[model samples]
Target: MKLTPIGPAALVLALSAATLSACGGGGGGGGAGGTDAPADYVDGATFTLGLSSDPGNLDPLMGAGSALFAVTQFAYDPLVSVDGKTGEIGSQLATDWTVDDTTVSLTLADDITCADGADLTATDVADSLNFVADPENQSPFLGTFLPVGAKAKGDDATGTVTLTLASPSPFVLNGLGSLPIVCPSGMDDRSSLAKATSGTGPYELTEAAPGDHYTYTLREGYTWGPGGAGTDQKGLPAQVVVKVVENETTAANLLLSGGLNAAQIAGPDGDRLEKSGLSAAETTGLVGEQWYNHADGRVTSDPDVRMALTQALDLSELADVVTSGRGGPATTLAVNEPVACPGDSVSGALPAHDPDAAASLLDAAGWQEGGDGVRTKDGQRLEVTFLYQNNLGSSGDAAAELAVQQWKAIGVDATAKSQNETTLTGTIFGAGDWDVAWVSLNVGSPDQLVPFLSGPAAPDGTNFSAIDDDDYQAGVDQAMGMTGTDSCDTWLDAEALLVQKADIVPFANNTVRTFAKDAEFETPGQLVPLSIRMVAK
Candidate 1:
């Protein structure tokens, strides 16, 4: 399952610093916007960002159903923010917080003034929570986000909102972080959160002129923020106009041609970026991997066979064909993220390379090489059909083709097929018609991984592996029900358990980047730069 967002989980916990040097694409020109003097803003500096896909809908509360959720961050504020770079809790609408096992008390900042100049309060936070939790919203990601029993309570004066959880969940804060607070004054009707709407962030969303462009004007005299970004960007870019360039090639060409400042580039757009003097930024995320359906009662259910399959493929070689030392192999979903057990962190959870062990594991599983160079057991061919979407960009295609060859070399009968975006989603992700599929799934939280990885969900669910191992499910259950851990032991243990299952093979995590042609702006400091507040050039 290929997913997106939150560039490197570390930005929230660490610093965006020089992370841009890792992805090798996109660069910005430097200049002053409003910092010098809000009134004497640069005559020609306008921060124009680009989105490769159309933001389907502008409602953040609508969940991840459309690409628009990412853009909605431009005009919305979540109760909390999970620092992508740091993996720690950071304030957004909430100023401070206190968390026990199942309850979280948030002290909402009183100084917040929305675009409408209405004083933000705890009551506004409650209203936002209720909006997402409303069953009528029909958001596919609602269950994983709002859940069933979570509640918000508090008053507007003190600006305190208390979140009560039904269980100890590692994702309670993250879930809140994902929830965007709407204006309570007119929030009773969701239509108030319109495209050309108002928000309280550093920049006020003045226009979302469908596809062609969107604009944001500085919220004059605005000073309230939750820290990190909220405090750092004192002066805003005079105006930020985001342009929609759906083609990566055109977007990259414009960035290189000095037309636009920065554009997110994937696929062939990255081919010449390394030598283009551009920075490559990235962080660990929902890595694209090879998923084998074990619960479907295929040969993949055999533990040794799974191990052998792992041994047969050479990830190092695969990386070679991937991005010239840019791709890092993944063994599990959260292998790249920092996780603690109870009191401390450990490195034992990292994925390791073991070519010999992989070959041996498969051999022991009785998948011997047949006369035709294909592995077989009792006349059954060791074959699995893998599905991949062609539009994901060059990296996805190159990665899929490499996977096919690697698996075939090990006597595994593997074939790669390309499908369009909608058809692929309907057939493989939705219909579960695939045996083994290579996909990328990136999100803000690792706990929400359940709805996509395991657990019972509507319409076939995201258990792409079709694996129903009790042991594996137990680890997932424990990971999902955690609040805070002082160490990474249990987290690593669960990660190892999931990796050993071999139902999902995490190969590499890519970067989400932005570039600018003018100096009046600074890096957006977000995986999807527009999601978090943007600092002016």
Candidate 2:
């Protein structure tokens, strides 16, 4: 597939780190279910959802983050949508579509119109795709969702938009389903998109209060939702308020007091929320994954050092600590449900905990242990600056502390640093000042991860860790040739190459829970715009 070559200047602020704590959740309950709303649909009700952090730069194309992705769904619509339960491709803005090796042609619905009452043309849709496809635009979704080097053409008379890809992508339709298309107004004046909505979704942004909250008013006569779902249904909220609540506990308290309609509680607060009899929607996501910087000059660049560090800690204990005993061992890099390849690639692929073995590896690498129990090679101490997201709450902090103690016992000087989502993204993808990171990048398709794993290193590309495993790349090359599930076996084997060599250590998978009091909704990754329903208490 074609790849967007992002320069150093753009890399610093382009890629936003995915929040592990707020990975996936919606206003409904018990797995992905929340579509079954009560018979009474409370009209004129305001649905309040809590976010752990502010979704900076509201422009959908330029910004990326779980918060921003979640918020964008309220005011923007994708070309298509995949059913969270059946995995079936459904219509959103595009009424129908035909996909093949190098081309995808989508037929737009005639009735679709922008929030401003302007008719949405096929040209608008094509323009949105082409904007992201251009490298100069620096859209983070380029390689992840929209194929790089892709081009689009539109015929307004026939209401059809055609896209030609540079290479054959097995999961092209699924990726397109996640990309939000901007209306002509937003595309014309990109600056207005920073704090406004100009899409053809079921709602329009009425107010944006950066760090406080974002309010969206429901748009009447919205009938072109996923699978022809309409906003005229009973119980649909008249307004949506996304309140910024950084603390999980505070969010839970709000949910209990009925002050908020929904909030995702990943920490200890989740237990109480489950018993409170509120509706919920749960999505399994990677909660604890470790990555070593393979860039030159970093101590973790050495293969021996990476393997030694992997064997230094009891991953099971770390997993429990990180997830607060609620999660289990990770099975695959793609942890979310409706996973294209449903199989384990992590078990028996990593080294078991053995401090003695770890120390031996260090000795073999010519690192001598000093009087202070720190290893030094060529007059340089083996010091590591580890980073983890602070949104993982107290459990994440505890897990980092435990990992540090374990590394110290092996004569490695490791320090744990906690950063919020925005700072952490910049540190890993921009500053490149970290040795190891406990962060997660969630995606449904294995192809979506290739850009972040194998391509050019940061400052030049999205491969933040600078991973350069030839065997993994070979496997991916082979897998890319096949189509759909036919390539799953090869994809799983490719993930194994990374694990067997200790390039990445994925340890925990948590059932991310989002609780709702007076509302019900579903989230494939973010809340489905059409699945939301307001209820009277």
- Poorest stretch of ten by lDDT in candidate 2: 1-10
Clashes of each: 53, 4
Q: Predict model 2's lDDT versus the native.
A: 0.78
lDDT per residue as tens, model 2, 1-537? 111000010121111211212112223222212365445556788989887767778898875556777778889998998776666789989889998888999999878999999999999899999999988776777877887778999999999999999887788888898788999999999999989988998999999999999999999999888888888776778899999887778888999898788776678887877777664666676777898999999999999999999999999999898889988898887644467788888986977889899999999999999999999999999999998776677788899999999999999999899876656667777746899987677777777778678877876667788999999999988887788889999999999889988999988877667777866666666667666677656
Instruction: Report lDDT (Cα) of residue 526, candidate 1.
Output: 40
Q: Model 1 scores what on Cα lDDT? A: 0.54
Cα TM-score of candidate 1: 0.73
lDDT of 1 by residue, 268-382 (tens): 5655654576544444333345566565456666767666666566665664444434555543454323321222111233234565666566677777778988888887998
Worst 10 residues of 1 by lDDT: 7-16
